[model samples]
Target: GAGVSQSPSNKVTEKGKDVELRCDPISGHTALYWYRQRLGQGLEFLIYFQGNSAPDKSGLPSDRFSAERTGESVSTLTIQRTQQEDSAVYLCASSPHGSLTDTQYFGPGTRLTVL
Candidate 1:
Protein backbone atom coordinates (compact mmCIF):
# COMPACT_ATOMS: atom_id res chain seq x y z
CA GLY A 1 0.00 0.00 0.00
CA ALA A 2 2.47 2.60 1.16
CA GLY A 3 6.22 2.88 0.92
CA VAL A 4 8.49 2.12 3.84
CA SER A 5 7.61 4.10 6.98
CA GLN A 6 9.29 4.33 10.38
CA SER A 7 7.82 5.44 13.67
CA PRO A 8 9.15 7.84 16.30
CA SER A 9 10.95 10.00 13.75
CA ASN A 10 13.14 11.17 16.60
CA LYS A 11 14.00 9.90 20.05
CA VAL A 12 15.89 11.08 23.10
CA THR A 13 16.85 8.72 25.91
CA GLU A 14 19.20 8.24 28.80
CA LYS A 15 22.45 6.36 28.33
CA GLY A 16 21.15 3.10 29.68
CA LYS A 17 17.59 3.23 28.43
CA ASP A 18 16.24 0.79 25.91
CA VAL A 19 14.69 1.84 22.62
CA GLU A 20 12.61 0.09 20.02
CA LEU A 21 12.32 1.31 16.45
CA ARG A 22 9.61 0.05 14.16
CA CYS A 23 9.42 -0.23 10.40
CA ASP A 24 6.55 -0.97 8.04
CA PRO A 25 7.61 -1.99 4.58
CA ILE A 26 5.72 -1.99 1.33
CA SER A 27 3.26 -4.78 0.69
CA GLY A 28 4.48 -8.09 -0.79
CA HIS A 29 8.10 -7.12 -0.53
CA THR A 30 10.32 -10.06 0.39
CA ALA A 31 13.48 -8.33 1.40
CA LEU A 32 13.93 -6.02 4.34
CA TYR A 33 17.08 -4.47 5.78
CA TRP A 34 18.09 -2.28 8.70
CA TYR A 35 20.93 0.18 8.78
CA ARG A 36 22.48 2.79 11.01
CA GLN A 37 24.08 6.13 10.19
CA ARG A 38 25.95 8.24 12.63
CA LEU A 39 25.87 11.99 12.14
CA GLY A 40 27.71 12.88 8.95
CA GLN A 41 28.64 9.25 8.38
CA GLY A 42 27.46 6.82 5.76
CA LEU A 43 24.89 4.12 6.29
CA GLU A 44 26.12 0.85 7.77
CA PHE A 45 24.20 -2.36 7.31
CA LEU A 46 22.81 -3.76 10.56
CA ILE A 47 20.65 -6.69 9.61
CA TYR A 48 18.71 -8.21 6.73
CA PHE A 49 15.74 -10.52 6.49
CA GLN A 50 14.75 -12.14 3.24
CA GLY A 51 11.79 -14.40 2.64
CA ASN A 52 11.91 -17.50 4.89
CA SER A 53 15.66 -17.57 5.25
CA ALA A 54 17.33 -16.85 8.58
CA PRO A 55 18.11 -13.17 8.94
CA ASP A 56 21.65 -12.09 8.14
CA LYS A 57 22.69 -10.28 11.27
CA SER A 58 26.42 -10.37 10.80
CA GLY A 59 26.51 -6.64 10.35
CA LEU A 60 25.12 -5.93 13.77
CA PRO A 61 27.88 -4.25 15.72
CA SER A 62 27.19 -5.88 19.04
CA ASP A 63 24.84 -8.03 21.07
CA ARG A 64 22.97 -4.93 22.20
CA PHE A 65 21.36 -4.51 18.75
CA SER A 66 18.84 -6.89 17.32
CA ALA A 67 16.05 -6.94 14.72
CA GLU A 68 13.33 -9.19 13.45
CA ARG A 69 11.01 -9.23 10.43
CA THR A 70 7.94 -11.38 10.24
CA GLY A 71 7.04 -12.88 6.86
CA GLU A 72 8.48 -10.01 4.89
CA SER A 73 6.38 -7.33 6.47
CA VAL A 74 6.97 -5.36 9.62
CA SER A 75 10.37 -5.19 11.27
CA THR A 76 11.56 -3.84 14.58
CA LEU A 77 15.03 -2.81 15.76
CA THR A 78 15.80 -2.86 19.41
CA ILE A 79 18.73 -1.39 21.25
CA GLN A 80 19.31 -2.39 24.84
CA ARG A 81 21.11 -0.24 27.40
CA THR A 82 21.66 2.45 24.82
CA GLN A 83 24.95 4.22 24.79
CA GLN A 84 26.05 7.55 23.39
CA GLU A 85 27.81 5.78 20.53
CA ASP A 86 24.50 4.22 19.58
CA SER A 87 23.04 7.62 18.77
CA ALA A 88 22.27 7.80 15.09
CA VAL A 89 19.58 7.48 12.49
CA TYR A 90 18.11 4.00 12.12
CA LEU A 91 17.02 3.25 8.57
CA CYS A 92 14.89 0.53 7.05
CA ALA A 93 14.55 -0.50 3.42
CA SER A 94 12.88 -3.17 1.37
CA SER A 95 13.36 -4.54 -2.10
CA PRO A 96 12.11 -7.42 -4.20
CA HIS A 97 15.53 -9.00 -4.53
CA GLY A 98 17.05 -7.81 -1.25
CA SER A 99 20.06 -6.36 -3.02
CA LEU A 100 20.38 -2.88 -4.46
CA THR A 101 18.65 -3.95 -7.65
CA ASP A 102 17.20 -0.51 -8.33
CA THR A 103 13.91 -1.26 -6.62
CA GLN A 104 14.99 -0.80 -3.03
CA TYR A 105 13.10 1.83 -1.05
CA PHE A 106 14.44 3.57 2.04
CA GLY A 107 12.30 4.92 4.84
CA PRO A 108 12.78 8.21 6.63
CA GLY A 109 14.96 7.11 9.56
CA THR A 110 14.40 7.36 13.28
CA ARG A 111 16.90 9.63 14.96
CA LEU A 112 18.19 8.47 18.37
CA THR A 113 19.90 10.73 20.81
CA VAL A 114 21.44 9.46 24.04
CA LEU A 115 22.42 11.77 26.83
Candidate 2:
Protein backbone atom coordinates (compact mmCIF):
# COMPACT_ATOMS: atom_id res chain seq x y z
CA GLY A 1 0.00 0.00 0.00
CA ALA A 2 1.14 3.54 -0.71
CA GLY A 3 -0.26 4.82 2.58
CA VAL A 4 -1.66 2.96 5.55
CA SER A 5 -4.93 1.24 4.66
CA GLN A 6 -7.51 -0.33 6.95
CA SER A 7 -10.45 -2.44 5.96
CA PRO A 8 -14.15 -2.43 6.87
CA SER A 9 -14.05 1.18 7.98
CA ASN A 10 -17.22 0.69 10.02
CA LYS A 11 -18.39 -2.29 11.99
CA VAL A 12 -21.49 -2.88 14.11
CA THR A 13 -21.89 -6.02 16.13
CA GLU A 14 -23.68 -7.49 19.09
CA LYS A 15 -21.49 -7.63 22.15
CA GLY A 16 -19.48 -10.82 22.79
CA LYS A 17 -18.63 -11.50 19.18
CA ASP A 18 -15.01 -11.59 18.07
CA VAL A 19 -13.59 -9.26 15.45
CA GLU A 20 -10.42 -8.81 13.48
CA LEU A 21 -9.22 -5.61 11.84
CA ARG A 22 -6.60 -5.48 9.13
CA CYS A 23 -3.91 -2.95 8.31
CA ASP A 24 -1.60 -2.57 5.33
CA PRO A 25 1.19 -0.13 5.86
CA ILE A 26 3.32 1.81 3.43
CA SER A 27 5.97 -0.17 1.61
CA GLY A 28 9.51 -0.21 2.98
CA HIS A 29 8.44 1.12 6.36
CA THR A 30 9.90 -0.57 9.42
CA ALA A 31 7.55 0.15 12.30
CA LEU A 32 3.87 -0.66 12.82
CA TYR A 33 1.52 0.30 15.63
CA TRP A 34 -2.09 -0.14 16.67
CA TYR A 35 -4.15 2.28 18.71
CA ARG A 36 -7.62 2.54 20.16
CA GLN A 37 -9.64 5.75 20.41
CA ARG A 38 -12.79 5.79 22.46
CA LEU A 39 -15.31 8.53 21.80
CA GLY A 40 -13.59 11.86 22.47
CA GLN A 41 -10.45 10.50 24.05
CA GLY A 42 -7.01 10.80 22.56
CA LEU A 43 -5.35 7.88 20.79
CA GLU A 44 -4.06 5.15 23.07
CA PHE A 45 -1.17 3.07 21.86
CA LEU A 46 -2.05 -0.59 21.88
CA ILE A 47 0.94 -2.33 20.41
CA TYR A 48 4.06 -1.37 18.52
CA PHE A 49 6.35 -3.58 16.38
CA GLN A 50 9.66 -2.28 15.23
CA GLY A 51 11.72 -4.42 12.90
CA ASN A 52 12.30 -7.88 14.43
CA SER A 53 12.52 -6.74 18.04
CA ALA A 54 10.04 -8.05 20.57
CA PRO A 55 6.71 -6.27 20.02
CA ASP A 56 6.02 -3.65 22.63
CA LYS A 57 2.62 -4.64 23.97
CA SER A 58 2.67 -2.23 26.87
CA GLY A 59 -0.57 -0.45 26.07
CA LEU A 60 -3.08 -3.16 25.33
CA PRO A 61 -6.01 -2.67 27.71
CA SER A 62 -6.33 -6.40 28.34
CA ASP A 63 -5.35 -9.80 27.10
CA ARG A 64 -8.44 -9.72 24.91
CA PHE A 65 -6.84 -7.06 22.76
CA SER A 66 -3.96 -8.41 20.71
CA ALA A 67 -2.18 -7.53 17.49
CA GLU A 68 0.40 -9.02 15.14
CA ARG A 69 2.52 -7.72 12.33
CA THR A 70 4.17 -9.91 9.71
CA GLY A 71 7.58 -8.53 8.83
CA GLU A 72 7.48 -4.75 8.34
CA SER A 73 4.29 -4.47 6.35
CA VAL A 74 0.87 -5.95 7.10
CA SER A 75 -0.63 -6.28 10.52
CA THR A 76 -3.86 -7.32 12.17
CA LEU A 77 -5.65 -6.57 15.42
CA THR A 78 -8.05 -8.96 17.07
CA ILE A 79 -10.44 -8.27 19.89
CA GLN A 80 -11.95 -11.23 21.64
CA ARG A 81 -15.17 -11.43 23.67
CA THR A 82 -16.00 -7.93 22.68
CA GLN A 83 -17.89 -5.70 25.08
CA GLN A 84 -19.75 -2.46 24.67
CA GLU A 85 -16.75 -0.71 26.12
CA ASP A 86 -14.78 -1.94 23.11
CA SER A 87 -16.74 0.25 20.76
CA ALA A 88 -14.33 2.73 19.24
CA VAL A 89 -12.13 3.40 16.25
CA TYR A 90 -9.16 1.04 15.91
CA LEU A 91 -6.36 2.83 14.16
CA CYS A 92 -3.06 1.57 12.70
CA ALA A 93 0.06 3.56 12.05
CA SER A 94 3.50 2.91 10.60
CA SER A 95 6.67 4.89 10.19
CA PRO A 96 10.30 4.83 9.19
CA HIS A 97 11.57 4.54 12.75
CA GLY A 98 15.34 4.68 12.42
CA SER A 99 15.36 8.23 13.69
CA LEU A 100 13.85 9.80 16.78
CA THR A 101 10.34 11.26 16.72
CA ASP A 102 9.50 9.69 13.40
CA THR A 103 6.28 10.89 11.84
CA GLN A 104 3.68 8.14 12.05
CA TYR A 105 1.23 7.82 9.21
CA PHE A 106 -2.30 6.91 10.23
CA GLY A 107 -5.03 4.85 8.66
CA PRO A 108 -8.70 5.81 8.44
CA GLY A 109 -9.39 3.05 10.99
CA THR A 110 -12.08 0.49 11.55
CA ARG A 111 -14.93 1.83 13.66
CA LEU A 112 -16.12 -1.02 15.87
CA THR A 113 -19.49 -0.60 17.51
CA VAL A 114 -20.46 -3.32 19.94
CA LEU A 115 -24.09 -3.32 20.89
List, residue by residue over 54-75, the lDDT tens digit for candidate 2. Answer: 9999999999988888888789
Q: Which runs of model 1 end up more than 4 angstroms from their true locations?
A: 99-102
Candidate 1 residue-wise lDDT, 1-115, digit = tens: 6889999999999999999999998888899999999999999999989999999999999999989877878999999999999999999998876755647799999999999
For every model shown, what is its TM-score relative to the native structure? Answer: 0.94, 0.94
Clashes per candidate, residues 3 or more apart or on different chains: 0, 0
Q: Per-residue lDDT for 65 in model 1?
A: 92
Cα-based RMSD of the predictions, in order?
1.3, 1.3
- Show model 2 residue runs off by greater than 4 Å: none
Question: How far out, in Å, is residue 55 in model 2?
Answer: 0.4
Task: Please give the lDDT score at residue 70 for candidate 2.
Answer: 88
lDDT of each: 0.92, 0.91
